[model samples]
Target: MPATRRPIRQLPDELISQIAAGEVVERPASVVRELVDNALDAGATQVTVRLQSGGVRLISVEDDGQGILREELPIAFRRHATSKIGNLHDLESVATMGFRGEALAAINSIADCAILSRANGFAEAFLLDGRTGELRPVARSVGTTVEVKELFYSTPARRKFLKTDATELAHCIEAVRRHALARPDVSFAIWHEGKLVEQWRRCTDLDPVIALDQRLGDVLGQEFLTQSMRVQTIASDNNLRPRIWGRVGIPDAARTRADQQFAYVNGRFVRDKVLAHAARSAYEDVLHGHRQPVYALYLAMDPARVDVNVHPTKIEVRFRDSREVHQGVRHAVEDALAKPRSAGLEVAAQLDSAPLNNGFSVEVRQPQSVPMYSAQPGIGLVSKPEYRFGMQPDMPGHKVSDVGAIWQRETAPVADPIPQEEWPLGRAVAQLQGIYILAENTQGLVVVDMHAAHERIVYERLKNQLNSITGAGAHPRTIVSQPLLIPVTFAATPDEVATAEVHSETLVTLGLVISPFSPRTLAVRAVPNSLVQGDAVSLARSVLAELGQHDASTVIERAQNELLSTMACHGAVRANRRLTLEEMNGLLRQMEETERSDQCNHGRPTWRQISIKELDALFLRGR
Candidate 1:
């Protein structure tokens, strides 16, 4: 028997609201995120959050922000009604964190919700019951307070999906942490099970940098500031306005998971693919394959260029031009991480400076170039007979030994003291274990990993030479390409095929020759000569993939860089090679002029300083 179809009907308001709630109120943490967004949007200076039973039983948020009017109390719980926006134009540039107006309505549909508020000029506060639509006079300060109880009580099925109490509480804390990081001027406090668990005090400093640093220390831990590098960049091209600034942890501080990574757009915490990919690409050379880079990066741009309405949670954003954002973030982070660790050494110097016994004040100066080694082939590697110290002829009354002739010729006379500001890394005193170079400076002692330092110097030189050869506007006599005898062919997606056809010129410039052989297959005919050791098929596939995703290809350059890195490592001076004092000092001088000389290709520190005060502390001096 054929069953008769039932007539379609519209859902009741209560049922419709519950369905919408399902999207916005997934768990306790979701509720916390919505409430906090509302508080911040209201211009709250201080916000307090209290939770019980992992916020499944009770969740309360109180903020000293502009409160709602008594007449608008009921409207606040109606879906699609909000004061954040009034027209379609307002939607294009939504600066506030919570503008959809679905948060209050969604929360009320699944839990017992109540809002208590007293407008600035109101004589008394009013309370509205979300479940019964009842209004009553209540005593409250000139702000807003939202209390939610028995989360998902109306939806038994949803309640069953929640995790254990501890896990939920942890997520709630993380939500608040994200907000605290975004607004340093706002104080935030959180309590769970009637105990204060975390607090971030409001920053009062007038200097933005100082305030941000203080807040970062308070939220990410003081150790993070000590171990991380500050990144700031301003980029604007055409109508696109982008500014990326934040702190990125050094490669040594990377973690296994991506939990510590944070990215925000227009002050709203987001999980954008462009931002994530940019950061990961920047760290490709430095971080281990399994480890994730950690950073708190904030990107500020005109709101009109980004759309936050793509998702119900508003945690994902769509940019008008993703390519620009990708370039901006990637370049900014790369430039920051590529700076020499000399800045840290300078800071250490200031902290370690003390009065000498003879009343000579030790002053640490900014790093400056000093003459050490005369230009010679393979100066960064083993010293050849043709290589000589630039200072060799300047020193008189010094005997040059065959084995240590370079060292004796360049060494300052025993009677002459080197000025404090002359050399930051100081003069080579001795070698340790044939691996480390020990030197003495005004502050204290300097120990350097000779192999690592030399590797970095060589790698930088190789990169610069490559850039000069292939850089824009440089006409090369011939492109260096290695033809693959087999002519590897592989299947390709339509987007990949299109990218190859469109960016073929770019590929040629990078020394790759790819052609579309069929509708869905591509043939790799040639690759960069420098990257001949790498798999041609894999390199072609990676390049196509990058072009498809980023509209830009870095595969060829990255592969060439990897090859150069290997060459540098092999060509660098090896441990136990017994370098003379002049060779050691030459490396030090080169490091000061080389970019990113602090860490090697593998991201390990090349040099470290030990202050005299630190040595004294070790020996318990003056105690």
Candidate 2:
């Protein structure tokens, strides 16, 4: 059976506005975000937000910026009446936050609203009421104030969807937090009921980077500042291009959730897929398991290249060239995290003679390197000889056959006095239980996880070898292969068989050879040299699935990296293995030169510093 369709007619203005309101206003937080956006677009330096009942009963935002004229007061509440854009050209390149101008009209249809403003150079102010459309003279300074009360009052169904007061209040606060993180030169304050909740003062530094760093400490926390690395880079092709700057947390600071990640394009906050995927790719090699990285990255580029009108909330954006943006962000983060943290540590005085508890303090002398007086002649306490891990005679990916032959050492004479300050890792003194290395430095004590440190060193070396063999130009490079004595067979689905046949050349470059044995089975003839001991069937299936869904070259490269990582893990030094002082110091020196040596291949810290102050507090000296 068929039913008759309703007649198409233009709805009344009130009914039309309520329908528009459904898209613009979701909860109290929605109203707060819109009002704050408008305030910021008005060039406000100081903004204040007041809330009651989690912003349902009352929400007021006051800002000191350019105000509107009295004659345009009534038309400001009309649909699509925006001062930001006039024609199609202006809409194509919008720099202001509130361009659509549907917020005021949509909000007025669902709640009680009012606007009081006084334009700069004007003598008097005016107030406009939403419900009555009444305009009268008012007393106010040269700025604007917008008040929204009884949100979703007209639509009872919408009001039922609200959460508790405390939960809603938390959402309101988070909305403000996003804006605060993007702008460091503006002051923001929030008040709930009659008490002040949160406030962020403006950073007065002349340098933008220094100001942003100060604001990050104030908003995120001092701990974040201490544990994260600063990223500032400009990526360009020909003329000026996008500039990226922010703070990325170290591998050890990764979080269990993605709530702390923020990305901005041209001073506007957005959550685009290209940015998210690029960030995740940059951290794929370092982070372990399912941990998420925390960062706040800002990108500055031409406004015409991005379109912000993709969503009603303006939180989603579209880029003309997504690949450029992806590579720029990924490389920026990678370069910032490449340098080892040990290289940045500064040497400080170990003991402060300031008295505590009115008692005398003991002065401790820094450990000095023995002047070429060790048991082995020509080898000083901390050797300056060249020590390197010897590669196999054939290829680089093979297992390190012997631990004893790993180091290639050469002795050199020491003329000048060498101190511990020159060696950041200090001199290796002893080994603990054959699993840890103990050392003394200018700062204090340093404990090294022997197995974890060696694993990272081996992993990095394997990557360099593979890169050199492949010519390191772009992806889809060839990997060296080794033939197996006997072929392995596996049951394959119809789709898997088809994928293997279609991408046969791709498989060959990755050092894999798979052929159809029957209608339902496949045979693996060869495998990568480093993954010779791995499961041939499982590796073939994983590669087939990835080639079926994602980009072939990317999937092949990732699979090759997985094989190298596995080889490095198994070839590292094992626990309960004894080593001499020379071997232990050799490992420490390698760690200092390796990039991202602070964390192992699995994102766990390989070593930690225990400053002298911590040691003093533990023993309660001078107390």
Maximum-TM-score candidate: 2
**Which runs in model 1 stand beyond 4 Å of their true positions?**
1-22, 235-239, 343-385, 388-427, 440-445, 469-558, 609-623
Over the stretch 180-217, how does candidate 2's per-residue lDDT look in tens digits?
88889888898999678989998988999888888888
Q: In model 2, where do residues sit more than 4 Å from their true spots?
A: 1-22, 235-241, 345-419, 469-558, 621-623
User: How accurate locally, in lDDT, is each candidate?
Assistant: 0.74, 0.73
lDDT of 2: 0.73
lDDT of 1 by residue, 1-623 (tens): 00221121233444334322328888999999999998887778999999999999999999988788888889888877677755567677888886677789889988999999887667889999998999999999878999999998878998999999999999999999999998899999999999999999999998767788888889998766766778888556654758988888877678889988989998899999999999989887667568887899999999999988778898999999999899989989988887665533423224322222353223333245533433333342224433321112222223323223222222222223234345677676666777788877777777889889877876676566456654465675233555766677778889878988987876675567899999999988876543443445666666666556543455445465764575466446556666666678767766765777877888777887777776676558978
TM-score for candidate 1, residues paired by index = 0.73
Evaluated against the true structure, the overall lDDT of model 1 is 0.74
Candidate 1: Cα lDDT at 397: 27
TM-score of 2: 0.76
Q: Which pairs of residues have clashing backbones in candidate 1?
A: none
